[model samples]
Target: MEEEKRTVRAVERALDVLLCFASRHEWGLTEIAGRVGLHKSTVHRLLATLEDKGFVTRDAATDKYRLGLSVLELSAHLFRSDDPSVVLLPEMEKLRDEISETISLYVRDRSERVRIQAVQSMQAIRRVATVGARLPLSVGASSKVLLAFANDGDRETVLADPSWPAQLDLQTFAKQLDEIVSTGYATSFEEREPGAAAVAAPIFNRSGKLVAALAVSGPSNRLTPDRMHEYAPAIIESAHRMGALLG
Candidate 1:
């Protein structure tokens, strides 16, 4: 029993080492060990094991450690599952086909939103976002909708943090949130990423709580004010369909 517990601890430490890389582009052995609160030798051994498994890799020139391609491959496979993505895919595809723009599905994780699925548009010029990317709760249209519909305590926690990246003026953000709730959607132009514009609507479960957000993003030129207004109804319809499926 003691040995099993030790093994679990080791595995957790190894995972912690991997998670430590989340905030940085790359890190060295010493830095990783210090952040993970493990011995240098232990971290070195774990890193070696991960590298062998293609979960981490050592930079050829800098000798720093970065996430390996296998992690991305694994995440891609997970996204293709028949669970949430399967239920949402048809709706996402419908939105993509309707607007000929990229559609993304996101769910809130604690204080942030993570993109769980994306259907890239076939258009020659399009905005592209990865499947596992994380966005702050105060910036993009989807994030704002999520924030608006979140419980009061969660909303307060996210808005109270001065270090939050979006850093909108609190009073103004609060006012705009009311509009988002009233309309059941949100819109942003070149807010989070340059040259990208997006419109997002909230997905709710049978219990009438926000469960996810469906967003359509594309190049600013293509997703102009007129185009956004044109796409809003389709995006909202997709969100409603996804919410019903989830229910």
Candidate 2:
């Protein structure tokens, strides 16, 4: 039992060391040790093991550590394996063709939302959605849908985060989440980026667990509020279909 506890603790500490990089791109051994509240020798041992696994790299000249390519490689593997976005690519393409706007699939990553896949609009004037791009969970149609369907604890954690809009009223945000849950979709007008507009719907698994959000985004000039409302039904239907395929 003690051995098992030690093993779990070791894993937790290693993960803590890795997560420290989320705040900064690089870290020195002493800095990492202080951040994780571990001794320098223990941190060095953990870094050595992590380096062997290609999860982190140490600079030869500066002795600083940064995330390795293996992290991105693993993220790519995650997108290909059992990810609903990969399975729903055809649907996203069809939606893009139908709406003539950018169709993106977003998944919540802690307090952030990440675009896993995107089908860009063919028009010259359109919002560009890039895969693997991380956006704040505080705004945007996709972020609203992702947060609305999230568990209560996670929802609160994200909203209370220091990165969330300080001036935005929590009560109003709560009402917005409730509205999304009741309506089965969300729409945003220049909430995240000026001149960018989007409408999104939640995608769920066979177990009714919210998995990802399907968003149709474009320039406000083209995807106006009225047009977004018009596209809401199609986006909701496509999201439902995508969820069904997750089984």
Candidate 3:
């Protein structure tokens, strides 16, 4: 068991190293060690293993590393597969184009919502969402929409979590969720971030299983509650199309 734990830890550290390249294209050994909070020697070992597997490539002249062809190959396979991210990205893009706001696809992961895919707005001032961001499922429009469609147990688990705001009225929140279910969309103003607002709708698979939440978000000045409500229908329509295509 101890050996297995060590192996898992090693794998996790290697993944952490790889994840550093998600924001930037390349990194030197010292920079990567600093970023991953690991020693330079340990990072070098992991980098060597990754390079051997063609997962990363090192530029000898600059002593910097970048993701290699294997990552692209895996991404290609993922896109070709029936992944929801690949299937729904087009619709998400369309919604972003129409509303001129950041569009995000989120799925509940335990008591948090994870953004798996996003199409950022082109506006000079807009909300920006990271693809792998994990946020509390207690405030944002997408969180509410997702929880509204979640099973009873999931909803209870989320509400029972201690991370929830102590001052929030659970009864009022439940009623708001019911309203969202009835209207097929939910809108929030400055619920998650101080200057961000969003509207979200649930995405259900063909079998009527809630699969994800589709959200349109932007700066509060641009996506006020009224403006978000005005765009709710378009967001809902796009989410429905994505769900249908999930088949």
Which candidate achieves the best TM-score against the true structure? Answer: 3
Please provide TM-scores, in order, for all candidate models, with all chains considered together: 0.78, 0.72, 0.80
Off by over 4 Å in 2: 1-76
Worst 10 contiguous positions by lDDT, candidate 1: 77-86
| Reference-based lDDT, residue 189, model 3 | 89
Q: Write the per-residue lDDT of candidate 3 for residues 1-247, one digit (tens) a residue.
A: 9999999999999999999997789899999999999999999999999999999999999999999999988977665557889888888888888999999999999988999999999999988899878888888999999999998888888888888888999889989888889999988888776998989999999999999999999999888878988898888888889999976
In Å, residue 120's CA in model 2 sits off its true spot by 0.6
- State the lDDT of candidate 2 residue by residue for 74-130, as single tens digits: 877675547676789999999999999999999999989999899999999988887
Q: After superposition, how far is residue 139 of candidate 3 from its true place, in Å?
A: 3.8
lDDT for residue 31 in candidate 3, whole number 0-100: 96
What does the lDDT read for residue 24 in candidate 3? 88
Ranking by lDDT: 2, 3, 1
Worst 10 residues of 3 by lDDT: 75-84
Error of 3 at 166 (Å): 6.8
lDDT of each: 0.86, 0.92, 0.90
